[model samples]
Target: MPQPTGPATAPRAPATASSPPSAPPPFPPQSGPPPQEALAPRAPVPPAVSEATRLLCVGVHHDRAFREAVLDELYVHEERFPAPSVGIDAGRVLSHAVRARNHEVGWAGGIVGLWLLGLIVSGGLLALALLGSVGLVVARWIRGSGSADTGVGLVRRAVAFYVRWLSRLYLVYLFFAVVLAALFLGGGTFSGGSGFGPGLSDPLGFARLAAFLTLLVLAGIVACVALRRGQFARVVSEELSPSRFPHAQSDPAETTAGPRLSHLRTRLRAEQHQPLVMYEEDWPFRGFGTPFHTWSLAIELRPRGEAAPVPLDNGEILRRIVPLVEALRVPSPRKDPAAAAAVIDRLRELRLDECVFLPADGLEWRNGAPYAPDAFAAHRAAALEEGGEARRHFLRIRVGGWDEELVVTVFVRVHTQGGMLMAEFAPHVLTPVRRGYRLAEREARRHRALSWPGHIAWALVHTPSSFGDSVRTLGGWLWGELRRAFAGYAGAPAEGPSAAVRELGTDEDLSLFQEMDLDRYLKTIQDRVAGGVRTALREAGWATDEFDQKIIHVANGGVYIDSAKDSAIGIGNDNKISHTPGGKGGGKK
Candidate 1:
């Protein structure tokens, strides 16, 4: 079991002899508007507490200390990080709305068919037509011109909204449909022999039906009340949890328990001279066989009194780091360049999609500058006075192909206060709709090309193998895409570095093909980036203490350490790291 490094309660400051006592440090400055002057002021830090402890205490007020350490090492500033905006395309929403309307029409037609069957069985054709006509007219009006505003646009918006909450609506529809079916099956007025007359003989059946319908109506009214109170959306979001899509299953052996940074300060108290280390791995988007993975290692250096021989600029640091990173790239032989070349040729010949791995370039640096010191001027001044300087830099590499692009960003910062070096690696993969369609078309053609006997045999084997589940999954996937396309726009600035776009195939084009070797491609890229950084840092002699190292798993905007047995409830585990048993004592070997 992992152990705490210090006393459970906050530790007292160490006493110093000969030197005069210093005043306590002020709280860190915050950005944005100031609070109302009438609001009460914050309490002052205790004089006995050290400056470092004061900062750490404030930072870990809400979160675990280990979590804060991981975050700080990664240089993850929520204010500076560029998160992607969730916005939908208006045109796609309109198209999806039209498709949904058509589907509803087909459903109406099925109802008409059922009514025809009833007419043959019980002779209520006139009544059936009357009932069906009213439903059809109302549905048509809603899909057509029910909007007092921008008619069709309003209808489209309504359709999109309904689709977003389709899971809930589906339950209501099922209940109502079952009730209606029960009424029909119970041999009621639809049988045509019955009318509003004293000859009515099935009073009990009628009463049961009326009671069941009344209960259903009341249940629906309660559901509406909950929805009006905004409870439904909250519940759905919670049920969906971690992300919009479900996590893919993987080998259990692939996961391992490691140190969590949330307990860093406690460990630091035990071994003040030793550096703290944390690692995080992220598979940002998965479940469609995402090709890329990112891993970040954060090392927190102990504060040093002496300055470096010379101040290093971002360009010089990147120049030294690039070679180390590039050295980990997949070798030409392993990459099978010849096979990739052949695949490209075949794609061109067949008019199918192509995959092209652009020539890998050295690390490119951007946004390098001295960090703004206004927010934490006192802290900055103290670090500078002690011969340390703070700076930040962003490095990116773009790997582009015919239909896919994998972009990686390395955010590096030097913290003057702790003499810390913070590095973060973020990888994002883009797969356009055209690419997905092309893959689907390729699969269909492959199925068609199989021998008739073989195809029949394959279908026999495959049809029962989660066929219904697969169809529903695909439907859900398409629905999500359409809903996202219609989602409301955010006015925030666009996130992350921009990529150059190159048009390959038109949206109308598609071809039959097997899966691309994207996993290997992305893995190679990841290896190179991780390997290069480790090598560079080692050569610089900054990471000599191997025992203090940690690996973290970052996902869904949270950082976590790996362990043999799952420890926490809220943390994610897909990309966890392994550690030796009882390795938590300041990472001592």
Candidate 2:
């Protein structure tokens, strides 16, 4: 939720109630081209956090296996910015998934081994070679040939497309290899490579027989490996529903994936409650929602007439503002079950969180010793009262609407330094999660159906791609592990983390009404904040003339829509996303 407001750069004089201008052009219109900030560089997501999100997307979008659902939410491009984590525990989720991922990875390696074994056999080798070459050519024809117009056509996208078919082709190779082994079954004997119990004698035939046995063992392994993935999806889905959206405080002991995984989950949860250092270094708005729109205004704290300024800190400034901020509170649940629940749900979504971000390097560390009480107290002190350039505190308010599909979050930070009082308001919106990501929930809640033609057809079409997923997943996983190994070796491994999943699965652009709601929320909060600050300044006998002028301009991008305005680029109406609007009034947004 944000409004186009802040320190006004415009030179217009403040309007008096007795006489106001006829009209002023809308300063920043929603219909216009995307805001400049939209084009800014994406916040770098930590590897662990990103991987955890990908797994959830995988489970939700693709039910059969646990592989990253690449490029599924093509339009969810904007909301991918890493924000403060909401309800989910990143550490626990990742911990549980590690064993399942490793299981898949082991099978992936087995698949590679089977392919190599097939290469050593007589007729099997040539068939694989022919099919692989033909598969590449046919796949290109179906996928369409790559164009050199894009960079890394040969090494990147083109190769990636080529790689996608490798698992599928290998699957075919396994079948052909098995058939060849059967055909030569009579020609080999287990005891000797001679005509002992068959028609022909050949060591190659024996080799084929052993390879075929290995393939059978692998098939069983595939079945076992597929189990953990489903378990993960089920556990996650059960805990995180319409009410929770993304976060669920899952019990590690009860929802155990494995012994090692359970232990890890327990340890991680403990760390979340008590952390030794600032680990998520890259995430500044940690434990807060994604910051989308932010405006800051700095005003001189000097008194109007020469008088001593009252000593002010973050806590004191907040004391003057909290009363006004309390105007928007969750009302008591009304009667009428459905209406009451929806209203309460909407109100409940509007959450306010307080956290402090502090330094870690200088702090003493003793691996076996308990986390120092003094360090924790220091953090609490900074969050509640103290404010410095480094130890920054914030008031974070989040409103999750549309069954937690769309979220509007506003963050407020106030501090006084060097005779200047700076106040900042930043609003972040997380658009609705992709429809595909909700498929898991649908599949679970709905009644079982007879295997219909359409369902079968869909499966058949995706079969080849599905078989290929694990190989691709393995490659990516291995790369990440290798990178982490290197980073750890260099003593620069990423540590701190506060990451949310819903943002990663959101629509690229927000809907028209979503935009309107966002504007409304930001304006509402910003106005209240401005009023409280002005009141504080006045109570202290400071000049409020300049602040008032800037406030007016910031309120609506300095525009009176009815006024005669200079020619400017129009806000073209071109919202491409489709989303359902919710809750008309009474905080049912």
lDDT winner among the candidates?
Answer: 2
Residues 171-247, model 2: lDDT tens digits: 57665766676556546564564544433245565556655554554444344344433444454455434333223
Model 1, runs deviating above 4 Å = 1-296, 300-417, 426-523, 535-589
Prediction-by-prediction clash tally: 17, 11
TM-score of each: 0.27, 0.58
TM-score of model 1 (CA atoms): 0.27
Candidate 2 stretches greater than 4 Å from native: 1-84, 106-198, 201-254, 257-260, 270-283, 286-290, 302-313, 332-342, 345-349, 363-377, 380-387, 402-405, 417-419, 430-436, 440-507, 558-589
Give the Cα lDDT of each candidate: 0.29, 0.47
lDDT of 1 by residue, 1-589 (tens): 1111111123334545653577343332211112221122221111112121211211221122222232322112211111111111111111222222233334334333433443443333223223333333333334553343676767665764454344234434544654564355344442446543221246544434543544444333333332222221231233222231122122111122123222322222222111110111121111111122344544554322343333333344455555544433222332654442222211111110111111111212111211223523433334322433121123444332322221112222222234444444433333322343234333434554566565445533322212122233344435544543454212222122111111111121112221132333334444454455445445444452431244322323342323212121112345433221211100110
